[model samples]
Target chain A: MKRNSTWKTVHRYGVYNKSTGAKVSLTGGFGYDYTDGSTATRGFISPNGAWFDNPTVAFTAAAPTKAVTAQNEAKTPYTLSWAPGKLSKKVAVVEALKASGPNFFTAWVDNGGEVDVRITNNGGTYEAKYYTMGTSTQIANPFTASVGDDSSSPIIASEITSNKWLGWMHSPEKRTQIYWAGGASISFYQETNMSADATLLGKTNGAGNTGYTTLYAVENRAIADATKFPVEAATWVASTTDAYEYGRVNASADVRFYFTALNPPAGKLARTLYLDVNPAGPDAGDKAIMFNFSANERSKEYTSFAATPVTATLNKTGSNLRISNGHTSPWSLGIQRWQVLLTPHFTSGALVRLGGTTQ
Target chain B: MIALKADGTVYAMSEPMVLNYVHAASKDMNENKEIVFVKEDGNNHNPVPALCTAPTASRHYPGGTTDVVVCSVEPSDFGTKTYKLRYNGKWVNGLPDMEGRNSENDKNGFRVTMVNPKAGTVVTHTVGGVTTNYVLKPLAVAEAFLPESNAALCNDINFTTVAQFGWSMSDLPSATMIPTAIPNLGQSAGTSKFEVLGRQWRRISLSIRAFS
Candidate 1:
């Protein structure tokens, strides 16, 4: 009878029979011969406890396996098949029995036997292929149709043409030019002697014109005529001469003197007239002088009853005046000197004439 | 009567004898005589005598209650002698009456009197026949009327009457009596209602009690 066992016939101490839980000591001189030479004495025990010299048996360990389906017109890319074992473990496909390579692929173990992977040419003309991880095995289909390089990757310089690259440069034609407004030219100088013939619009040169010269000249015209024009100084008209006379009279009697030609000129008014009277002799206690014009003219009284040596004024009235001594008591007849004056009101250029009596 | 002779000699005779002599000499000659009296006060001691007319037989006294006397007589035997009254060390004339009677009534001299003297009483007296007026002024006594003796109850129970001897009670009396009973007797009360009363009796003594 043949019984399955797990035993090693080439151990350092001896050999162990896994099926029977038995260990044999190699120190005992149980010399047995096998196929190689006289020194090869390791062997296995048979089911009946008989030692067999041939220890080699037909045994193999199970390994993970995969099967692939070929690509066809309906399925352009090939597919890999594997049995569902430890579903929690991750399965990956690799090329050339390496864990990491350009053609490596990974997926969850629970994905079963179906997985879709996109292939790209990576900027090359050749097609991409899929393989299992850590094996020299490949899927059945080697794809020839390229899906192109990854669009997110950095682009090489040779990918863009010269004309397209030049579109990003700034154009000098779009630059702006600055401008300044024109104005009057003002000059500033620290220490300078300047001379120029400039006409100032609203300015004049003051008196002396010491340092800065101006376009306009100024002059003084403080006193001017009504027309605002300059003229010479004013001149005064001469006054007429005075008249005098002497007379005597009794007490309480009247003494009269007359100036009949006293008149004002045309376009002029009579301004004032002055009269003076002086008496002589001790018997004349008091005396007065009076003036009377014609009945058609105005009369002015110099004094009612006054002492001698009296001077008085008569304002402007269009009339002649008659000078006379007043009638009063204590007036003895005595010699008296009397003078009269008459003045006229006139304009700047008007002529004036005055006439009066002195007695 | 006194007479002046042509020889510039002065002579005095009896009024009857002078009258007879004037009648015998000439019918035109008449007797002329005048008498003047002076009075002085002892209080003022004025040197100048107050002139007055001669007193009649009935004595005339100066007004008011002032005493005066005529204490000096230099020639007492002469009937027409000059009499002087020393008043406050100053001599004043004291004229006798027609009967030659010029003695004072008492040792204090003459005491002038007013008939019914009272406050503001005016009396006229003729001193040496000159009439003068004197006004009598009496002491004032303040008095107030109480309506009832004990029937009217004073609002303040602790009230008491006051006796102000020489003081006057014209506007504010020394003690005030209110008819209404005080609500808060001898206790702190709101001052607003009693502030006027408090000012009215500011300088007086205050007592709050019930009294009848």
Candidate 2:
């Protein structure tokens, strides 16, 4: 193995809006680590107070405390997947997101999600899978022949399903590229510790199928095709049907996608989408709602007008939001605001995480 | 067809037409045409009355008691016998007289009486073209009837022989009713032709009544 390089700030950035003239960060933005692991553990920590103030970026040698916030458990599982390229430019494009946190990556995991990365060669088309681990184990189908109520499971096929895997990748495709795959694997992150010496399930020159490398991680979440947003580099139009704007998000990145209502700001619109935890309702389910905010009185409407419902399986893919009880629209209300941070990374087509490649 | 001499003897036609039934025996009267009736409303009612004679007014006589022979067909011709009343009042066209058939007891008929008016009261009653003034006291009473009473009430004038002042007319007593009595009611039976000196006596009271 070769010696790794040290981490340093190459290009730093700050996001601002022309309308409000306020700088902002995404919800649940992940941290990054340069080749050596030190940079990933620290630097650019959000401030200690509320959202209205700047997300204070502190640089200290102190590593990130890995203890989970409510956000971590909520995004119980994450998944990462991608397509590999032969040359470094193809890999460079996919790896740039991983190296530097962009406006697209989403997650608070200091290391852009401990990616469970894997590689695969579908006949000649090489594809990769990317994923992460979650605190929860795979739940049962909760169904019976007579009555099955598992339609909302992120995984199909009594496991996790993906499209093209439907006809075994053989469909005269013209935009009907809709299907599901990926299920709970018995051995995902089955190994307990990452500090000790460990080995992946398969090697590069293994049996007849050495072409695929299966990786794993704990507390991971799969960027379902429905929620994955790959940015301009190897850009992909996000497959999310509910995005308020036409934008993109990377699979390795875990952050709540901030957008306006279906009717975006008229000329140059800038609105904030909040994540408020609904008090345990009649069902005692205190789910957080993603609300769009305007600097004016428009924020109060998120609970009633212009709120979208999300599936439980796809709850917070590290990309969900939380609106503090007091944060508000118009960027006022020091606490009631859309305070989210999303850090995006490219998945060089790897099958890693809880529900990834069969290998 | 009758005679109404100034002596008060009213004589009618032998066939029974009235002479001057009202003005007869009335002082302040004249030989004026006795206006018996004056028809009104163009009076085209019924068999038009006769041209000269006017019998008294009558009704149905609808009872079995002694009643006056107030007949209708005695030639009461209103158009031929009407004597225009001297309309001396300041009223325009004069106050109207009730029609002949309704005037038997009507107040709008010709009236005459005497009064001495108080100061400020008007006593001018036109006779011919002569006008006179006799002021009198004010009272709620209506205009008087006789110009003589009006004149007396106003100026305290007296009624006497007309030949003297034209203010009045009456008679003194005859020889029998004289205060001397003529000893035996004869003009020559009086005693003191040398010592008796006296004034003339007058009638009892004045008769100031309506005129013809």
Candidate 3:
């Protein structure tokens, strides 16, 4: 087998030799060729006798295969790998693979079989491959590792607690009951704001004639405090000679009493005020005074001393009654003493106790 | 009546008048004559008669007569009920007398025997040839439920976390049945249900940075 010469250069035109009966020789820039049995000099020829101006051939290397470490189910660090080869200056790209979708690269490193990758987000499958530089191969299968928000399969949940402060009071009527009675004397004095010691007097005769009783001076002046009386009380003239004087009398004397005030304790409910008079005569002619007092004063009297075997009855009118002086003769009856009773009424109920720590 | 202030102070007044009841002066038959009731329209003054039945005029008799007009009433009538006594063709401006004879017989005027009267219990009173009947109805008491303070955290949750939990007063927990429990929500086993004025509350919050 004969080996063919390599061509150094090629010329566009062919040359002919006239001496030595057409000697054939190959030059640097020309070639000897035979065309239709005619000797000629032409452009350089390839070893395979093909034209030299043909396109150049190219050599390409195969893509490297990749293998990745199992992705962590938690937020931990993991590894990625590729098939070993001549260490190229190219870098390997690591990326995370979305479920059945495209891969997103998080980092890149020099070409190596195995590279460490860190996952900060939720964890899942990952992909890695060698990066191509300045060519169609520049893009590589991204290496990625799965990351998770938390370590548990299902996210852990927390519970919440709360507290509140309260200020509470029971219904006022349900707390406690207050019994109260208040009344004013109907004497000429008509004093509504009398001292605590003011005495109300009534008289009775042997015949049980209920007549007007005398309103003596407000006794116990020494014990009376100025603060107890209203401003109007100071203007009244106190009787000098007969500190105690008799009121005008009639066949049937009727005296009236009125309630001045009714105040119950906090958390207590007031029922009613009961009024009755105590006479020196037999317990034959006393009547009940029925009235209600709240924050205001009342002008009505519920009971009267008209005709009697005076049995105490609940007086709805809240009126004043007369006591029989019980005197057969006008001069026969002397000074008699009588007292009025004022009692408060209340309903029995539960009491509300306050002031304590609660949760 | 006692007035309670927000600062926890109480002020009381004596001789407080009964709400809605008014007094009118009347002519007296004799000096110091006991006038049971009076009616005045700012123009005319009339005295209510002694206790006699319906269709009969009130008669004025000597003092110390046992004859008296009797009527029954309830405790709830104190502030809400209106009474008009009649004498001599005029209506009086006072409630009826409900005085018992003595302590042993305590059933006086306006007896409050039952907690409340049955529906349609009519109370009738005849005076001055006119009879008026009053029907007793159930009393309506005022009630309310209030929050006293902000809910505090009972657990590790902080205020911010508690806020994040979307806690609301409408979602308050079921209160324990006790005297201290609020009405409608919780009340003691045997006690009557009282109205709830207010209550204390609690809440919880949390801040999470690490998992454990």
TM-score of chain A of each: 0.10, 0.16, 0.11
The fraction of reference A/B contacts recovered in model 1 reads 0.00
User: For residue B132, what is the lDDT in candidate 3?
Assistant: 48
Per-chain TM-score of chain A in candidate 1 equals 0.10
Tens-place lDDT per residue, model 1, B97-161, is: 11111332322332211011123333232234454443323232221121222443443334233
The first chain of model 3 has a TM-score of 0.11
**Regions of model 2 farther than 4 Å from truth:** A1-117, A122-322, A325-359, B1-212
For A1-359, candidate 2 gives per-residue lDDT tens digits of 00121111111222223334443323322222222233222211121121211222211112211221122334322111101100010111111111211111111122322322222333332222333321122222322322222323222243332232221211111111212122211111111111100122112243322322222221223222322221111111122432222222235232222122212222211121211113111112211211222111223222111223222221111222222233323323122222221112213333323211100
Mind listing the fnat for each candidate? 0.00, 0.00, 0.00
**Please, what are the lDDT tens digits per residue for candidate 3 over residues B1-212?**
11222332321113211112112221101112111221111111011121212221242223322333322222332323223221111111133332222122233322111122232333344334454443322233111121223354334445665455768665666665324733454544443332222212211112222321
- lDDT score, candidate 3, position A312: 32
DockQ of 3: 0.00
- Residue B203 lDDT, candidate 2, scale 0-100: 21
Residue A36 in model 2: lDDT: 27
Report the error of model 2 at residue B120, Å: 99
Model 1 chain A lowest lDDT segment of ten: A228-237
Alpha-carbon lDDT, every model: 0.21, 0.22, 0.21
lDDT, candidate 1, residue A350? 24
Q: Write the per-residue lDDT of candidate 1 for residues A30-72, one digit (tens) a residue.
A: 1223333333433321111113233321111111111111122
